[model samples]
Structure formats: C-alpha cells, structure tokens
Target: MIMMTVLCIILGYLLGSIPFALVIGKLFYKTDIRQYGSGNLGGTNAGRVLGKKAGISVIVLDVLKVVLAAGLASLVSEPAAIWTSLACCIGHCYPIFAHFKGGKAVTTMFGFLISTSIFIFQEFSYFLVPLFMFLIILYLFKYVSLGSICASVCSSLYITAQLLSLDVNNLFIILASWLMTLLVIYRHNANIKRIQEGTENKVSWL
Candidate 1:
C-alpha cells in the first residue's frame, strides 16, 4: 500500500510538472510566459501574455492533468487518489522540471477539487456549489485571487461537513482540502500583501 501510494505521488508529480503554459507560450508565441505578466507559469499569466484563447487552453490542460492523476490513483484507493491530487497541486506550485518555479496554484487547485468531487459524490451539484461561489466572488470583486481564496474556503465547509459526519471515506478529502488551502494562501502571500495596500490588479471580465 505504501509503495503504491508513493508511486502514485511520483507519477502525479511527473505528469503535473509538464508546465503546459510555458510550452504553449514558447511553441506558439515564441516567448517565455513566466517572463511576462505577473511572472506566473499558470493560466492567468498565460492569458495576460498569450491572450484569452491560450489562457483558457492552459486552464483546461492544467485541470486535465489533475483529473488524469486522480483517475490513475483511483486504482490504488481513495486515500492514494487524494495523495495523488495533492502531489499534482504541489508539482504545479513547484514544478521540478521548471526549476521549482510555478504558478500560484489557483487553476490546479480548482482542477483537483472538481475532479475529486466528481469521484467522491458523482453528482453535478457537488461541483456547482464551490464553483458558483468562486465565479460569484470573482465577478463581484474582479480579483481572481479573492475569488480563489473564497471558493476554497467555501469548499472547505462542505468537506468539513463530510468529515464531521464521521465518514471514514472522506478523511483524506478533508486533509487534502485543508492542505490545498494552506498552499494556496502561501502561494498568494504576495497578492495578499498587494490587496492589503489596495494595489492588487483587478481584471474586468464583464
């Protein structure tokens, strides 16, 4: 079991560290995405430097990586699947293949959450709740960082409900959610500082 868990984590990390945003930017635009807007190696920055199409594409690709990892780890067990999801997020945050420089873990985190919810609840409503919270917050505040933080916090309420019910099956889910929250906040520390000084960037998406 332990060996299988370790293998799942390694495989997830390897797949997650592919740096899709960088590849897309370099291959098509002949530029380094990380050297551009916000200097982030994720979809938002990719969008800023590469345009809406490339940004959306990167977001989809990043989400797929997490979903793929969850699918593979499901063969092991629920806990192992959660571990794989966690590993993928970590890889996205600090990709080994990218000199340990990566994005702020927003898209990747959402991908993992949506994928896990699919497998755990197998219900569309399970994905809708937090997604609605995220979109609403983003739409209202025009700050992607705020939306992400709020969405994760809202999702934690649902996961915490699962935990409080004494559902052993959800133990790993709760653990993974909290870890994602901490990692996301840590990654967004700079954004948090900017927001505090009312200097955070706000993109109007209408």
Candidate 2:
C-alpha cells in the first residue's frame, strides 16, 4: 500500500511536470515560451506568446495530466488519489522538467478540483461553480491572474461550506483544497503586487 502511494506521488509529479507550453512552443512555434510574456510556463503566457489556440491546447493538456494522475492514484486508494493530485499541483508550479520554473498553478489546481469532485465528492457543482466564477471574473476584469486568484478563493470557501454541511468529515479533502487555494494565491503574489500597482497585464480580448 505504502509503495503504491509513493509510486503514485512520483507518477503525479512526473505527469504534472510535462510542460506542455514548452513543448508546443518549441515544437511548432520554434520559440521558447518561457522567454516571452510573463515568463510563465502556463496557458495564459502561452496564449500571449504563441496564440489562443496554443494557450487553450496547453491548458487542456495540463488539466488532463492532473486528471490522469488522480485517476491512476485512485487505483491504489482514495487518499492516494487526493495526495497525488496535490503532488501534481506542486509539480505544475515547480516542474523539474522546466528547470523548476513553471506555471502559476491555476489550471492545475482546477484539474485537482475536477478530479476530486468526480472521484471523492461526486459533486459536479464543486467544480462547475468555481469554473463559472473564474470565467465571470475573467470577463469582468480581463485579467487572468485576477480571475484565477478569485476563483481559488471561491473554491476554498465553497468547499468549506460543503464540508460544514456534510455529516461525514472529509478532513483530507478539505485540507487539500485549502492547501491548493493557498498555493494558487502564493504563486500569484507577483501578479497581486502588479494588480495593486495598476500595472498587471490584462487580456487584450474579451
């Protein structure tokens, strides 16, 4: 059991560290995406540096990696699934394949939320609510960073509310959700500072 859990963790990290933006950029665009825009190996930076198609492609790939990680871990144990998802998020933020420089963990965190909603809670609302919140905020603010941060906040709070309403205590799920929320916020510290300074980059199109 322990060995399986450890293997799941390693697998989750490796999967999360795939660095799709780097792959797409270097393969087709003949550029290193990390060298442009915010230097973030994320979909937003990929879109800004490459194109909308590339950005959407990177996000879809990144999200699938997390889903795959969690799904594989579920074969071992449910707790392993949750922990592996967390490891995936950590790997996304500081991917070894990307020289320890990586994305802000927004999309990876959403992937985590989606997996947990499917496997653990079986509650789609937990995933859908925050996704809608993210899109709405992005539409209003035109800042991906702002939308991501706010969506993380929304996810944590909504998860907490759901936890409080449930008779069964899901301590691990609650803790994991909050941890990912904090990670998303921490990863966006620079963007938060920029937003405060009124210099944060905003998406050019709605």
All models, RMSD in angstroms: 1.4, 1.7
Off by over 4 Å in 2: 165-169
Each model's backbone clash number: 0, 0
For candidate 2, give the lDDT of residue 134.
95
Model 2 lDDT per residue over 42-125, tens place? 998998899889999999999999999999998888888988998998999999998989999978988998898887788899
Instruction: Report every candidate's CA lDDT.
Output: 0.84, 0.89
Off by over 4 Å in 1: 204-206
Over 75-185, each residue of candidate 1 has an lDDT whose tens digit, in order, gives 888788877988998999899989989988888888878777776656655567778998998888788888888877777787787566566767667878888888888
Mark the 10 consecutive residues where model 1 has the least summed lDDT: 118-127
TM-score of each: 0.95, 0.95
